[model samples]
Target: MRRESPHAGPLRALFRQFSAFAGVGLVAAVAHYGALIGLVEGAGASPVPATLAGYVLGGVVSYALNRRYAFDSDRPHREATWRFATVAGVGFVLTGLFMGLFNGRLGLPYLPAQVLTTGVVLLWSFSANRFWTFRP
Candidate 1:
């Protein structure tokens, strides 16, 4: 039998972790999007405030699920919460910047712009949280 690459195990583990994180993020996204739509369409709320509310809701879900499931992090609440918040704050800014560049400047449609922004933010969030917030 051929020998396995030295990096294969670590790379596989990282991919598994990323898969778990994405699952948690998908749940959070559904929560965020549902709340956003409800607030904007049902309650006649403006997009900004509704978006903020939805983001906060999603963040809460993300933190709880990620702590227990995604990273299996054992960091105390005080430490992890603040780190996650910092990462998320930066993520929000990145989202806006990406959206501006993709949609405002490039004139792409809203949905496609949001999709691109989401991909960028997903990478940023995963990297930051993996290295900083949930680092062992």
Candidate 2:
């Protein structure tokens, strides 16, 4: 049998990484929406409050997963944590803005607002994660 060099599969490598990211993102998205719905529907919280709670919970999960799995980061330091938190904070603001736009201003349904926020949040997160949190 002919052995193929591991480095010979660029397409496979990209797909593998994309798959890993997507998997992790799916988990985080569930966490985000779950908390949001739980707070708003179950706990009778307002949309903004629910969204805030969701962001906090989802942010924690996202940081943990992105650090350990997505980026395979093992760095331990206040600096790294703060940097990561800063990036997440930026994401939070953007998420909140869109959520508010959809839910409050546009009067869209909760789920629809959440879906819209998800796309924006995902793009923002990928940028921050790639450029800041896990930058080389």
Candidate 3:
């Protein structure tokens, strides 16, 4: 076997993987926060309820994109949905925490909180989906 460079192989691979996952996550977050803002401000839904609805929609979009594009998980549909839900539940907690900080404490408003929390939870969500939810 050829000797690998000290900081080339794994590091480069990790960077590429991170880039791709981050890209997909960005799209999913857009779907989530878009729905959230629309539901809350436009529809006059409560902040918490709007966030929950957004989470559900985001979870669905996230599973579809991440499975086919991000991790390429090919497991059966039912099993995959179960795993996806389990992973998403963790992200939901993180989302809620940051949202509470903004909406409850900081009073920064809904859209800003949603954007910030999406960034905070992106890495965690990607890792959980890759290692746990989509793993063989």
Task: Score every model by TM-score.
Answer: 0.85, 0.83, 0.84
Model 2 poorest ten-residue lDDT run: 71-80
**Compared with the true structure, what per-residue lDDT tens digits does model 3 show for residues 52-130?**
6788787887788777777777788888888888778888888888888888789988777777877778878878777
Q: Cα RMSD (Å) per model?
A: 2.1, 3.4, 2.9
- State each candidate's clash count: 0, 0, 0
Q: Model 1, 39-100: lDDT tens per residue?
A: 96899875445555676788889989988888999899899999999999988787667766
As a whole number from 0 to 100, the lDDT of residue 131 in candidate 3 is 81
Residue pairs with backbone overlap in model 3: none
Our model 1 lands, by Cα RMSD against the true structure, at 2.1
lDDT scores of the candidates, listed in order: 0.82, 0.79, 0.79
Candidate 1 has its poorest 10 consecutive residues by lDDT at 46-55
Judged by lDDT, which candidate is best? 1
